[model samples]
Target: MNLKTVVVGAGGISNAWFPPLIQEGIEIAAVVDLNIETARAQIKKYELKAVASIDLEATLEQHRPDFVIDLTIPEAHREVTITALQAGYPVLGEKPMATNMDDAREMVRISTDTGKMYAVSQSRRWDKNHDILRRTIESGVIGKVTAINCDFYIGAHFGGFRDEMSSPLLLDMAIHHFDMARFFTGADPIAVYAKEYNPVGSWYKGDAAASCIFEMTDDIVFTYVGSWCSEGCHTSWNGNWRVIGEKGTLIYEYDKAPYGEVVESDTTDFHRPLKKADITDSPLEAFGMHGAICEMIDFLKTGKTPQTECKDNIKSLAMVFSAIESAKRRQRILVEL
Candidate 1:
């Protein structure tokens, strides 16, 4: 079926979403934004046969699309998604799920009550390398994973709301890494101890750096250290990963394919002999945003649940909020809900 959608929010992020929707041959019925001109401009830029509207309720009343693509800003996510879900349309939204846990929980509750699919576009999880890393770890080649460490350092100079918001790195960026941690470990957070700060000479006005230690399910330890203001020797946006298991370890760095080593033989020597373990790329229908869109499309066509469905995605969002709370109280916070 050629699904139709009403896209809510036509800001800069919408550009990243439009191409994938077009590629999939999904019809965009309309684009809704507070700035009608912005929505109109996006429609024209993409040469979409879609209407531009300023009001979501009015647009929803007029067009019964298959779903709503919510590209609104973080603060607007809860309102836009709840409105669409309540109006009886499934919604695919940009990440950071909501500004706070209360809103995130409420959105999840409404999605369940309405029986509508509300999925977050956690674009990073769809990457092929990420998929392979997840598969390799799960394949038991590295034995049972005990600890996971990630380091992200990039000198981002985005001169927008990010430059001014408090906990910009944790709230605006680290959610991707946090979600990926869950994807790889298949573990939900149990508790978190974190410290957030603004590094010297940082361009962003808020706390642009953070170090968090998360206690995950199965007694797994996941540590994340990141800086949005580091000037040199930057790591990949996916971050550098080192996943340690009982019998071996896997390392992924610089956006390259991951490789690992496992115990080859049991010996009386100080260290057991090790052998190289190759990580092959797992097949993906698409990558990044396009990949996420494919999952939503498949979910609509079939009854299969997408990985980032609100109920599951909320746990990742909880990690972000819990980290912030831990940073604030200078105490470990339990991950609830």
Candidate 2:
């Protein structure tokens, strides 16, 4: 199948999307950005068999691509996605789906009305370790999962739009962990209570750290603790995780191998017999962003549904927004997914 795609944003992330497209032998029909020069630079840098344009609609109208890659910022996602869906094109876009739930629902509505696929790239779900953990829990090696906790700490110093946003950690970064928590637990969000704070010596204008507790479907509790401005012993971008089940626990670190241990059932309530269980990683065909694009490509060709389809991704976005709402209201917010 010959696939021609229009990528709507020519920022740094577009660079990441290109290699996979090239490897998959997909054609870039055009690159579009508000700044034509930025798009031109991408075309030049990649030696793309493509053109650069400042207008997404114009390029889409001209090329009539098989699909659209909406790499634009969060605020632009709804418009870009709607325009493409209206144009009868499927979309593989970056995450946070849209700036807010209303816009997200609108995009999903358009896709539903148009019968087109709109997938959000929840890239973290493509990790080998995460995939392994998900499978292990599903296989009931540790028995039915009851709770999950993730700890993330990073001293990110990106001096751009991120440093200027309010609730920077929750808005910009926490969505990945939130989405991953849902994937790991295989549950949709039910409710959330959260608190945000800006630690002293933090460079960000808004809160750079947060603690969120989400009650998920099936009585699962997912807790996330993250900081974007803490120094020393930073966790992996994927964070450190502990998944507790009825019989045992699964532990995963971003850089190291994930493992599980089982405890023998005994009469003692506090103390139990320990057992070391063999745990194996379920490797990925591709890693990170590339893996996500691969799935999108497969969806376009074979009509397989991507895991982060907009209808489903709204649940993940709901988790992010509910956490923000909880932080602001100082109360548990029911997720409206």
Candidate 3:
């Protein structure tokens, strides 16, 4: 089947989405960005068959794409995604879903109301680091997943909305970890108690570091430490998770592309090395382009939306915004589904 595709953003990570579209046999209907020059540059760089357009309405009318990829900024997420859904187009956007929960809910609603597939690019769910973590737990090498802890700490000056004081590491980054925790444990969060603080040495109105403790059903727990403002040498393991099951334990460490490690043992080695498991020769520089390929293929054949659904990810998103609310209230807050 010929799937007509359009990519709606043309900056940094836009290149990452292309190989999948190409590999999945989707037609490059158009590539639209407010900055036509940047869009043209990307079109040239990737050798895509696309026309750059300045206006959304004009571009949509011109392309009439079967699917629209919203790769815009976090704050612009709802606007771009809702517009596409309202116009009867499915959206596979980059993540955080939306910068906040209210908009996240609205994005989900628009998709549901309009019958369009809306998926977040929570691609880490398909990463080998996470796959190993999931496998170890399923093998029962770890008796029962009693608890999980994750962290996303880095030192970078990506001066923008992210560096601002209003940034919540939980919202901006940890949603991946939060979602993965639930994915790995297969449990929903029941309640959350969180603490947030911004030492005088930081950049946003939001906390510099936010720690959240989530209570899942069956007595399982999730604890997260998230921060964008830190002096430490940057590090993370996608989920960077440690699971304490009834029988044993599983740990995964990530350093992004081609450098992640997982160590499964009852004891903890915070700075552990990547496991020598049977790593596959997945064409990841296609940028795990295959996840989007899987998504598009499923939508075309099964007519069922994939895991990135706003409805499904909204739960993980709730954990993120709830932690922020708990931070604001300075008390544990009950998460409202």
Candidate 4:
């Protein structure tokens, strides 16, 4: 089915969006941006048979797209999404849902009021390795999960808006890992105590490093440490994850395949006996943004809800906000979902 979509925001991210939609046979009705020339440039770059517009309302009214793809920046997400949902279009939006919890809650309320679907494109969820890790843990190969740990270190030099933001790592990047934690464990965050700091040699205006401890449902403890301005020994963008359960442990290393090991315990000895692990590799049918776009298109056609629907995704956003809040307050904060 060719779903006609109006995409708002003609930024760098907008470039990654179109190929996936086109692959799914979705038609781009028009591209809208505050700068019409920017929208026109994207049209020319992609060779799209679509028009460019500075006015979203006028474009939507004229073309009447089946859905809206909100590619706007974090602050503008609420307005762009609310406008489209109220205008009778479902929205597939970029991550963080909104700049803050108040805006995110309002977006969810509008989706319910309008009865239109609003799904956040949590593109990381589409990674094949992450999917493999989730499946392995959920399979109980290591028994009931008790704790999870993730470490991410990168020395990025993104000299744009990110450099100007406060708590850049927590706000701009941690949501993916936080959401992945939720997805991997099927648990919601209860509380978090976090600390954000700027390393001595860091270049960002705000904290680019953070350590957070989260209490999730089912008594799971998730620990995360990350740095966006570390100069060396960078971890995978997906991070190095260790999921510990009652029986065994599952480890996902950076730039390596994921694997698990189950040990057999005997009452005879104090320590449990280790057994040969039956290792398996989980592969992806599609990865990253492409997979999420495919899922969004399927939801539009078949009414199959995307995993990161606005209501569910708000919890993930809550984790981000709570972490930042905890850091600012220098105390533990309950994740107010």
My TM-score estimates for the predictions, one after another, are 0.98, 0.96, 0.86, 0.96
Q: Backbone collision count in every prediction? A: 0, 0, 18, 0
**Model 4: residues with Cα > 4 Å off, grouped in runs:** 267-271, 279-283
* Candidate lDDT values, in order: 0.93, 0.89, 0.75, 0.89
Residue 200 displacement in candidate 3 (angstroms)? 3.3
lDDT of 1 at 136: 93
Q: For residues 167-261, what per-residue lDDT tens digits would candidate 4 score against the true structure?
A: 78987899999999999889899999999999997889999999999999999999999999998899988888999988888888784767766
Report the Cα lDDT for candidate 1. 0.93
lDDT of 1 by residue, 1-337 (tens): 8999999999889989999999999999999999999999999999999999989988998999999999998989999999999999999999989999999999999999999999999999988889999999988888889999999999998898899888889988999999999999898999999999999888888899999999999889999999999998999898999999988999999998898999998899998999997675698768888988898999999978999999999999999989999999999999988
On lDDT, the candidate that comes out on top is 1
Per-residue CA lDDT of candidate 2, range 174-200, in tens? 989999988887888999999988999
- Residue 29 lDDT in candidate 2: 86
For 241-274, candidate 3 gives per-residue lDDT tens digits of: 6677665455666644222224544356665433
Candidate 3 weakest ten by summed lDDT = 278-287
Lowest lDDT 10-mer window, candidate 1?
Answer: 277-286
lDDT score at residue 243, model 4, on the 0-100 scale? 90
Best by TM-score: 1
User: Lowest lDDT 10-mer window, candidate 2?
Assistant: 274-283
